[model samples]
Target: MDLLPLAVSSVIFLLVSVFLYSWKLNSSGTKLPPGPRGLPILGYLPFLDRNLHLQFTILARKYGPIYRLWLGSKLCIVVSSPSLIKQVVRDQDTVFANRDPTIAALLGTGGVDIITSPYGPYWSNLRKLFASEMLSHANLDASYVLRRNEVRRAIRNVQEKIGTGVDIGELIFVTELNVVMSLLWGGTFEGEKRDRIGAEFREKVSKFIELLEKPNLSDFFPVLARFDFQGIAKEMKDLLPSFDEILDYVINDRLKIMDSEQVEGELPSAKRGKDFVQILLDLKEQNVAEESMTLTQIKVLLVYSTTIT
Candidate 1:
């Protein structure tokens, strides 16, 4: 058994080495932008400095305004000059509209939310939805009380701390989470239930954020993605259930309330202004566009709207 395992490992290593050498030795006929020559297979990945910005700046001085860099098997184009950047971003926006979504980002948003969706008609629709529903002045003005209350609550907590040390990041996260919760759930939860939910949800969000930034080998080398050697995919999969639990609870609760009110002849206007969650729910029900959003998409949108804010 041990011998078989060793032989398999050696074969895998040999295959990878052969592929790398062939990839390195082969030259593309098409000319590419100027850049420093890098190592075989791995390219500049192994030679990367900790200060990426500074390293890229130095490379720009040597290579020119635009250059190509190979990180593992991935090819990256670095644009340094202001004029070139403007051309890429403004003049030729559609040419470079889409982004390569990371594993964590793809999982978290389900590629449905405005942030992760590919640049196309669906993405344009999401952007319009964001502007009209989420970022509208009316929506912001409506959420003012929630934001104010959260800020005041944060200040009071800080005041209580007095001279003791405080973690500004933690305080800010709590305040933001509270405001988001109020906006999403419409004050359905209060005091202990809210605190418990907040604490639990905070852990999940923090882990998800960290995972978003975590460097995974699979990202650099697509061939290794299926193996998930770093367990990044596993961690993200584990968190999804917890996300579903909270989302389902809140959504189901609100749905019940909406049904009750409809049966009782109570209009939506009679209640407090619809929250972000309610608005999204209503949008889906009304089939606001040619493509109706799924429940999962709504949940992802809710998460994106709350967290990105």
Candidate 2:
């Protein structure tokens, strides 16, 4: 019995050792695209600049249209040539279309929103909802008045600040926010509350964008993700709750309206007008697309439809 046990242990140890050795050999033999070398372990991470696009352009000129760099342990392939871009984005669209959602995006969206959701059945449904339901000519026509009013408000806002060198980007962002929110829910933010909320939203969104672009060690080194040394993931998770709370309020408020309208025996089409929330809610009630539509999915759609615009 002792000999049998010893022999079994020895065989297991030998198999484990052989597997590790083979894995090391395979990893060493794997080919990757060529680019500048960097320090051990850290890779080219320490030398990256804030203006990464400019650096990428210079590197592309030196390293050719396509090159790879190791950002920590993550291998990033950069394609600069128009032909290569077209190949990736067009010809092999499906093959290369899926995005690698960053830690921040995963937290912010709960890994469900259409933009960052992995390509699959759920993503397909979201796309169909956008193309078939939301972007229909009828819906666009219904939303025209809201867009026109918001555009007019933007014009007035700009006019009031005409002599003060108003920031054009800020003006456009506010205008888009107003238009998108109005179309999504058929409501407008106005007066002091609007100003306060708009400022807060812009600040939070700006910070979110910065964090999204900032390289997180967790991204390059999966082993370090749990530690979140940069706090990028935590910050994004915190910011998301505020936005979610706002979206929740809007969603619940719409639900209340839907309940009241149902009790009053008002047809949904008549009671809710042509806003996006109403349309989605109506679809929910029909129970026809149950697999494709869920309450969580609807909420995710509403959040992104307003903000992403």
TM-score of each: 0.84, 0.77
List the lowest-lDDT window of 10 residues for candidate 2. Answer: 21-30
Q: Candidate 2 at residue 299, lDDT?
A: 69
- In the range 1-309, model 2's lDDT, one tens digit per residue, is 469999999889878866654453347545756687654456688989888899999999999999877677666899999999999999998888688888887877778878788888877778878777787888787677667877998889888886788888988976887676667775334467545654565566677677777778888888999999999988887787776666576567778877887899886545234678777777787754536477777767776665566
List runs of model 1 lying over 4 Å from the truth.
1-26, 159-170, 263-274
lDDT of 1 by residue, 243-281 (tens): 999989878877888888899999752445557777778
Q: Which candidate should be chosen as best, given TM-score against the real structure? A: 1
For candidate 2, what is the TM-score? 0.77
Which whole-number lDDT from 0 to 100 does residue 90 have in model 2?
A: 94
**Which stretches in model 2 have alpha-carbon errors above 4 Å?**
1-30, 158-170, 188-207, 262-273, 287-292
TM-score of 1: 0.84
